[model samples]
Target chain A: MQVNFWDRNQLRLTPVFFLAPAMLLFTVYVVYPIFSSLWISLYEWNGVGEMFWVGLGNYIEMWEDDRVHTAIWNNLIWLIFFLLAPLISLGLSIFLNQNLTELRFIKSIFFFPFVVSPVVVGLVFSQFYNPEYGLLDFFLKSLGFQPIAVLSNEEIVTFGIILAALWPQVAYCLILYMTGLAGLNREIVEAGRIDGAKGWKMFWNVILPQLRPATFIAVVVSVLGALRSFDLVAIMTRGGPWGSSTVLAYEMVEQAIFNYRMGYGAALATILFFLLDIYIAWFLFRVWLNEKGRL
Target chain B: MKLFISIIVTVSVVITTAMAGTLKITQNSSNANTQKLWKEQIIPLFEKENPGIKVEMTIYDHEAYKTAIRNFLQAEPPDVVNWFSGNRMKFFVDQGLFEDVSDVWAKNGLDSQLSAARSTMTVKGKQWGVPLTYYQWGVYYRTDIFKKYGLGEPRSIADLMYICRTLKKNGVTPFTIGTKYLWTAAGWFDFLNLRVNGYDFHMSLMDGNISYEDNRLDKVFDIWGDLARKGYFIENHASLSWQEGQAPMINGDAAMYLMGNFVVPNLKEGGLSGKIGYFQFPVIDGNVRTWEEAPTDSVHIPTKAKNKADARKFLAFLAKPKVQSMVAEVEGMLPTNNQSAAPTDKFLKIGFKVLSESAGLAQFYDRDTNPEMAKEGMKGFQEFMVKPDREKQIRKRIEKVRKRIFKK
Candidate 1:
């Protein structure tokens, strides 16, 4: 009845007190906003104006919205491309792991794209894809091919931005894979080689299962990255040539900020959150299973 | 205690400061000349006239200004704010964020002086703000290229088509446009609709009273589609910004561009100023090429402004012919005050002529229409340009957005 919440001497209370700042911050910034957005999603509120509640109207509208489908399709493309990043990064990490001369030095250079901001990365690739003076166009023209308008064409614009996104994404995955590869059990690898497990088989069986933690992290990051593919689409195409390149996150922000459709935007955010939440739950379950198997 | 004494001193100073009342003005531009005009001319002059009043100006660059205006206006309302005329302003005004300044208009007799842009400054029945500056959007063509091809300034739809044909024959694109940001396409739509169906029909459509799939819009898009299909626009235009589209015009590869007077500065930057000539977008229906896209920029006081009395004085000061002329000189913009002389620049003089002869004014498409509808409609316009065959689909898409946006 006379509990002192701030008592540091009490072990259980001490941990709670230690966690209090972070918990408070997380509640305010993360938990509160998530619920607030959910509540807002039920209303038809332009951010500045008074909110008028229209329960389920925004969700019903989303069901009929074709643009949502387009965004999902684009997000799917991003997901597909993102899945390749880990494999590519793993392959790249392994190749660089070899004690070739200056290989370590080359790695920092390769990771240069990751260090560059997404906005800068988007800008650089936009220049590369610019039809008139772009390096890609110039190279294609030199090769006796027609100059390609990748960003201009609606169908390919998402692909173009995704490819740009992958440049940095691959670097991040490469770092993750390299970290995983470093923590690999060398004796098991040596034993696998002794047992005639070589090359691809060595990678598939010996190296991979041990690298599960890193692979899981990379895949999770990639899925999140794909779902939240906003910056590249925003900077390069702006979901343009007719919303063909829009991803859910970008469209949500577009609706909220530009269109002043906060209610609709909040609905989009809720949907994106739920979709990601499902993936996260499945990922956690897989990790739990993997850990249980290890035990 | 020393702390107690310091606190007491601070309280009195704060009270004095509160009584003095700072008139905060938030503007969306930080142009060097404009800033200089504010510091050297307007602020100094206004302060001299009223010794007790202090002007606090907070300026933002374009992109930051766009979002910051909304946030700052509502949270810590400034006495005055700068915004675009027409629907963009109406958006905030309707939300009751901007203070009604019809009293300022009536007292100053602005209804007569600012007659040209008066309609645009009004939302519903009330004038929510005052138009301070505006610039005309029309066709800007390479004078030498036109002369070289004997392209008499296109006077009608037939004339425009003939120019396009003649330019193509000479291996020149008739018009260079970049729809990367989507609003460039809106410029095209505004002109075509204004020309083909005239102003009232165009305003009706923008007001969402007329449907996007109307026969009138069909006619507008038909002409636009024909233009696009003729290979008249810059190649790979959807990838380029309006600034990048200026390149072909600079190089004489494109004969003309339909853009705002803002593009004139870019032309100067591109070192192609003297070579370019201005023309109102030629008649389509030949009824009259009177309705021009001259998007007016307005100033307003927030309804919650602390120093409204000073803000009104500021707005009144902003409305004076000398101040308007100073703005015109400083910004290379058309003055809203009737008495202020238009700038003497060759291009500006012609802009004045075009505007003065106009039967009425139209805010540019994005400025005139609801933002949500404008976003979809511009996208539809961009798509239509790229694939004119999909005109019906595009119109339907825009119509769908319009219905959703305006219905509520």
Candidate 2:
């Protein structure tokens, strides 16, 4: 059989064409909703009534909304704590990576939390924080300390929820670190050892730098996870102890779906989207700059 | 070719069997015994009485069913779905989404059976749904706790404060509530609002004829703030579900809960059925005792339903005295049909007594108010619970929302 140049090229490219379906599905389901939500932010609709063009009214409302302010503050706390949580996990992973007798079991136990769903994690932690019957309260009472309602008081509720959120997140980071450690070059470690690089010096100069890819993945996921902190809040508190635990994602769902204020909810959602975008952009820019310097 | 022919025949048989004019009903009510009775007693009766008809049923958790119903209405609505009365159903009604049963209301004699109070369930002066059951909301307290603390069922605001003081000294949380969903707080606000300002204020607010900053409402907030400041409510009430908070009351760790008759079942589930006691939320002043809280449940046929005739038949069947009595008995609720036998459950009997004795019934806060205003208003109520000092700020914000929501 003879084939023309166009036919030959087309035949060669059929596999790539076959991938179009998945790409189309992704764009339709994921990309389109993001853009549509962004567009909806510019109007005021209560899901049933006529949509009024609100321009930037919803965004402006964010400035005056005390609940939104509290949410943003809580989100900042989540980002800071969530970002550092991964480093702690990585440290633990490295500690456990040493020649310990039960290292395999220890690692598996540490990784167990990540395998659980956030809803289960939230429920379990909420029970732990329960004032009357929870483990923490029981321990505190036994110690003759005042057993506080960790999930209720406005002063500490956000911190309690974030602690719950960090459990699964730390496990996630550990998995990444363990995988990164597996890919580490033994030759490079030996070369550092031969050059008198040992212990902290060895880890700081050689091992840490090599773990950059894993660290980048960890930070990105953590930041995104912190910004999208809804399931934990929903399961644990539903933005309560009087809206003290509301995050933007939860507020968006509550307003858009339950409250039927689609436009206002979209506006809140857009703010979350922008906040996430800025952090992700900064992260990528830093990575790009570092790569350029290496080049 | 033989296999393809066989597959086509099988598919046809399945479709024919599945779509045999069967009526599908979905509800969020999850009382297992009631569900069993509905299947074994009601369904069989409904099916046998109307030969060649079948009934299929599905139940969901309340929030899940709300989401499901909203989605289904936009896609494939059921023949009949249980729903809330008042403003919640109005959105569906306004969309031309529910079947107008004004004729059915008159034909089944519900117009007379249900009374003028039932008109709240109507939209645009047309009856769009059937009121299945409703019950009174009041203060449910642990009698043992009250007796131990030397307190009695509060009849007035001063008496209620006295009881709170007694309970506080005794180291019990004066009230137990979970406001995680925000609307539960509205129950307190609604009782206070009604007690402080009476039924007229509530009706005006529902009609969008009253301002959020009305002095009458301000007085309600004042009382709410006073209770909050006095530490009458459980700390961290916002972190728990209403059911979770019920535990403290059951265990005598908390002395009281402001709730509806539906909570009696939960109290029974908590093994406090005999221990629980009730009274109308104490009046702010002696004159305000006439106002009462009564939220209703109703079933409506959607306009877009494929089986409207069957749905209407089901509605008519539900309105029958026998079916009403069955629903009331199994569900432990007050039947809307006057001819329906009174509930045998003691707590439900108390609820019926309260309903009959009250001068008037006010719809629940969330239902009585427009949904848009209700959302913002309920959040304000929650905020007021959290920080009484936020009262002025919440009122201002609510005023802004009210204007925006009900603009002329």
Candidate 3:
């Protein structure tokens, strides 16, 4: 085959030409905002006024802020508890991966929470936790137990909001796992079974290894979701009962919008961005290693 | 068909040319009745009186207005906008985002008519806005419940404590407050601080001159903590909104709410109109003079307003006694114009008397303080109500915020 210099140049430029628009969009929407936020974090600017260079003043203030401490602690707690979604979803998906006709209906019921909006979920859970006239209160009283106001108590309010978030999150993870299960190799499972692997051993040894991609996706999504948990806290609690339920994302919005501390809020957002960036980098590195090993 | 289209275009042009000025107003009011009065009555009356100027008004819900005003004032400035008084108004005034309307105040003799709110509206000896309406904060109690318990309006802290004890003995919560939004708790803090440490101390605290951990505030917290620890407040108050807090009071499960005159309509809707009664927060110290929380809503021209002349005209119109009287009647709030007719609503009448007799007026806590400090301070107040034992910790946290915000 005879190839001219134009054809070689055309081949290289075609991919670049195709990628230019996406790269431009990504730069504008994603990359530029990150740098803009980083720049804004160094200034003491109200949303509508002159920007005063404060350098690390905002970060220093955030470091000593008790609310920031509370928010960071709440984020950590959310990260820890949100892992349960994938683990529980895996079990539920395995149980429902059957041929029974009735199981399909049961599976849909389990998927119901994911269909509802997070706002509605927060409101429903808020009513459920209402001490004066809620279902939990009613049941507790009927059972001769003290009615606990879950959302009001500072010590347990974060847990209460997490439980509400977990409902939809577990459903989301279950769907991911179920699709992964459907694509599993039947021959490998049969080989494992014929080699005397059965039940727990067969699932753990054969089925689990096949679900790696799904597991990886589920974990990454769950971690990101946990880190950005603003809606439920904003709706159900508003980081109330003295901000005991606040997370970094909610605090950032509260600072920026409600408190009109735009510079401080930018600093908070920068911190969150870096935290997310480190996780993503680690994830990509692990995936690269996996690919290199396979090759 | 061509002739008809031409006629339509000509008519629209004529209509547009007939009006010499377009006055745009953006108001922050969540009250449907108030919005209706503005659209149906206020705007029509203004336009009818000033045929050459067409007035346009847009109302936003309370919270949305806070952020929207910041953007529009910088980008597309309205002719006139409604805002708060005190430090809340000063936030924009200092930035020169609000036009100096001293001439309007002077031309209309608003200095004397709106003298009550003049201090709040003034910065560096220049008037920034015209006061619209104000409402008092006090204890709104069920008169029937008080009668049943044989308790007259509390005269002093001791007397209030006795009433609280009586109500508690009868198995009713003495006070109903919701701290979900946090400002409601600041109302309690304002009254307590005013009563215990006096108005000057309270103002100093709001200005960030006094630390939250200052010993002068110790007595105020002690009283508040005592009330909280004694179970005088409704249980799980941190979970409800200010509106939801009224449910207990309306149901007779709770006796009183320390709120503004704005709660009157909600109480009336809750079926406690005739039975509801108002009283000033009782004295805690004989030496301290009485100060009232009377947050005033006001109107101003943005510095970037296109029609400054008409905006001033609109402000002067709003300053008139008759217009203010209508505002007071429709809103069930006290008119800021001293020459305005007395408010017709019974609750507002009492509120007027209380405010008029007071030695000084303080805008509500959140309004008087820096926005950042107010938020943290209100949150601390809410926490104190929930966990009275954490008073020291909460105060320390609020003080930290105060230092950072005020650079103290």
Which numbered prediction scores highest in DockQ against the true structure? 1
Q: Which candidate would rank higher by TM-score, 2 or 3?
A: 3
> Chain A TM-score for each candidate, in the given order?
0.94, 0.92, 0.94
Per-residue lDDT of model 3, residues B251-354, tens digit only = 99999999988888899899997899999999999999899999999998899887788888889999999999888888778889999988766888888899
Across B26-141, the per-residue lDDT of candidate 2 in tens digits comes to 86877788778887999899999998788988878877887677777767888899998888788888777788988888887888888735766777789888988788888898
For residue B390, model 1's alpha carbon misses the true position, in angstroms, by 0.2
Query: Per-residue lDDT for A1-295 in model 2, tens only?
Result: 8888879799678877898899899999989999999888999986655688989998998788777888888888888888987788889879878777778788889989999988899999999998767899999999999988887787888899989988989999998998898889999999999999998999999999889899989989998998999999989887876677788899889888877789989999889888888988898899899899999
By DockQ rank, best first, the candidates go 1, 3, 2
Task: Name the weakest run of 10 consecutive residues (lDDT summed) in model 3 chain A.
Answer: A59-68
Ranking by lDDT: 3, 1, 2
Better of 1 and 2 by lDDT: 1
TM-score of each: 0.95, 0.91, 0.94
Residue pairs with clashing backbones, model 3: none
Model 2 regions more than 4 Å off? A1-7, A48-50, A278-295, B1-20, B148-150
Which candidate's TM-score is highest? 1
lDDT for each candidate structure = 0.88, 0.84, 0.92
True-structure RMSD, every candidate: 3.0, 4.1, 4.4
- What docking grade applies to model 2? medium
lDDT of 1 at B388: 91
